[model samples]
Target: MPHGFPIYPWLCLLFTYIRGLNSTVGESRMKSLLLKPRSCSRVLQGHPWVFAGEVQDLLPGSENGKTVVLRDSRKRILGSGVYNQNSKIIWRRYAWNKVPFSMQFIRKSIEKAIQRRPVETCRRLVWSESDLLPGLVVDQYGDALVVQALTLAIDMRLPAIATILQELTNAKAVVFRNDASVRKLEGLETYVGTFNDQVLEPLNLDIDGLSYQLDLLKGQKTGFYLDQREQHALVSTFAKGGAVLDAFCNQGAFALQCAKAGAKSVIGIDSSDTAVQLARYNAKENRLEATFEVENVFDYFTNNRDERFDLIVLDPPPFARSHAQVEGALKGYKEINLRAIKALNPGGILATYTCSQAFSMEVFEDLVSGAASDARRTIQILHHCYQAKDHPILLTMPESAYLHGLILEAD
Candidate 1:
C-alpha cells in the first residue's frame, strides 16, 4: 500500500478517539443529573421519583444521600434530591425548591409528618413517600415504634433516624424490620433488630377495645395490618345477628370484629398455622367465641358446597407485587371472589379488598364483575372503602393508594 493510504487510516482512528474523549469530558462536567424533557416535566408536576432510565446523563463524584442538582435537557436546574446510582429510583426528592440534606432537614420533615397524624398512642408516624420521607417508614403501636428503611441512603442513617423517632414520639422502643425483599433491589442487606438491641415479643396492642398480641420482630409488615383498622370496624356494621366468614383471616382482625359486632357465628380460615393460632389466641383474649382454623381458603370454599354466610370478608395480601404478576394476580382474585359470591345467599354482604397497586380500581371492579357473572348472581355495590386515614395517599403518587375495597350485596 502507498504511505498516503496508511495516513488516511490513522486519520480515521484519531477522529474516533477525539469524539469519544469529548463525550466523556462533557459527561464528567455534568452535575449529577440531566433529565430528559419528559422526566423533567414529571418532577415539575410534583412526582417524587426520578427513575434511573429517566436520566439522560449522570456525572461521577456524587455520593449516595448527597444533594444532586437535577436539570432539564436545556440545562435549567429543576430541583435537587438525595441521589444513589445503585437504586432504580435514583433520586428521592426532598423539595421543589432547594433544601439541605442534613439533620435539620430530617427533623423538620419528621415534625411535619407527625403534626398531620393523630397525636394518639397507636398510628402511623411516617408513611414513606406520602409523608415525603421516601424509603423510610415508621409506625407506632402504643409506646413502641417500628422503623423500616427500604433504601441505601435511609438504611445507612439508621442511628440518626432512631434517635429522632424516639425523641419525636417518646417511643420506649424502636424495632427495625428492614428485612423486606425490596431492600435487595436497593443493594441493602435485610436486617431486623431494636434500637435498644432487644425486641419485646408478644407486644400488646389495644385497638378499639380489641387486645392483640404480636411478635413485633418476626410479624408481617411492621407487626400488623394497621392499614385495615378502619375496615375491621366498618365490616362489623353488617355482621350483627348474621353468620360471618372471614377468609384469609390474618390474626383474626375482621373475624373478631364481626363476633364483637354481635354476629351469631364467625368462622375465620387461614392457611398459615401461626396466623391461625395467633388469631385463636386473640379471639380467646377478647372472650369472643370465634372459630379460627388452619385451612386452605381456596380448598375450603371449593369443598363446602352447602355452607353459606350472611357476610364474608376476602382481605387477601397483595395479589400483585410487580407489573409482571398482574395476570396471575387477577386470576387469583377472580377465583376467590367467585367462591365468595357462590357462598353468599341472597342479600349477603361481600366486603372484598385488594392491596395490590398493580391491580387498579377499575380492574378490581371488573374482577368482581366477572366473578358475579361466573357465579350467576346479581350484586349491588354498597360502599367504597380505602386504607385508613393514617396511610394517606399523595395526589401525585397514585401507587400510595394501594389498598382498595368494595362492600357489595348479592341479590
Candidate 2:
C-alpha cells in the first residue's frame, strides 16, 4: 500500500458516491401522496391541511402516523406531511421539502413554540397548528406542563414529546390531557395520565394576583382555561362600584376578578356543583367577597325575572363544535343573550363570549344583534375581545382563532 500516496482522496470520493446513492434509493422508497391537479393551490398557499377529496392517491407502503411525500398530479414534489387516511384531513404538512418526522424535528419545533410566548408561570406554551405543530397543545402550570395530543402522529410520539418538554421546561411533572373529542377523527383513544405514569398533585397557579388550585388530572381543558386570562382583567375594569353577575361562571374567575375590583356585589352561577364549590373556595382563598351558586344559568335567567345587575358576564363554553351544530348554536346564543339583555339594569354592561370556531364574527355579531332587537334594548359595543396573546393564531388557519367576545353596554 503506497503509504499515503492518494488513499485519503480516493476514500473521500468513494464515501461521497455511496452517500448520494443511498439518498436516491431512500427517496425512491419513501411513501408518496398525489393531489388532484387543481388541489395543489391551497397547500401552496401555506395551508397545512389536504382534505381526503383533494388527495388523488396515497401510494402503497404508506402508513398512518408516518411521514409521506406529497406531490402534484404532474409528479412535482409539493412537500412532506404526516398521513392519516382515516381522518378527513388526509395530510397535514410539516415541511415544504422532504424531511423525516424525527425526534430532532419535534424537539426543535416544541422549543421554538415555547420561546414564542412570554415566560409566565401559567400560560399556553404551544397552540396546535398555530405553532406549526398540528394537533398538539402544551399548557404550563407552575412547575407542571399539561400536554394534549389530538392527532395520531403526535399521539404516537408522546414519549418523545414528554422527554423534550421535561428537558426544556424543567417541569416537575408532565401530564397528558388527551381527552378531546377531536381525537376520534384520527381513530385515537381518549385518556389522561402523567408522563411515565407518575402521579401529580393538584397544581396551584397565580396569575395577575389571583390564585387557583386546579387538578390537572380531573379538571377540564388542561386543568383550567388559560385562554381567558386576558379577558378576566379586561372585564374587571368595568366592575368597580357596580353589581356584577357572572353567568356560566366556571370556577368563578370573572366573579372573583370583579370582587377584587371592588364591585358592590358579585354573584356567580354555574350548573356544575363541583365547579361552584371550587369557585367558592377560590373566593375564600383570595379573601374576596363573592357568592357562587350551582344553578343552570339559562334557568336562572328565565326564573329570576326581578334580578338585575350593572355588569353581566356570559362566558359560555363552545356551543358549536361542527358545521352541523351552527344553526342550533345560533339559537342557543340568541336565547342566552336575550335573557341576559332582559336581566340587565338600564345602562348595564354585558360581556359575552363564544369559544366556537364554527361561528364567524359576522354570524356571532348578527345573533347578538337579533337578541338585542327581540329584547327591545339598545346597546353599544364598547370593546372587542379575543384569546390571550399566549395562544397565537395562525392567520392562514381560521380555526386557530376560536375564542372571541364582545363587551356591550345596554341603554
Report the C-alpha lDDT of model 2 over 286-340, residue by residue, as the tens digit. Answer: 9999999999989998789889899999999898999999999999999999999
Best by lDDT: 2
Clashes of 2: 0
Q: Which one wins on TM-score? A: 2
Pairs that clash in candidate 1: none
Which portions of model 1 show Cα errors greater than 4 Å? 1-31, 37-41, 59-62
TM agreement with the true structure for every prediction: 0.90, 0.91
Q: lDDT by residue for model 1 over 83-121, one digit each (tens)?
A: 778777888776665554556677778999999987766
lDDT of each: 0.81, 0.84
TM-score between candidate 2 and the true structure: 0.91
Q: What is the C-alpha RMSD of each candidate to the true structure, in Å?
A: 11.9, 10.0
| Clash count list over all predictions | 0, 0
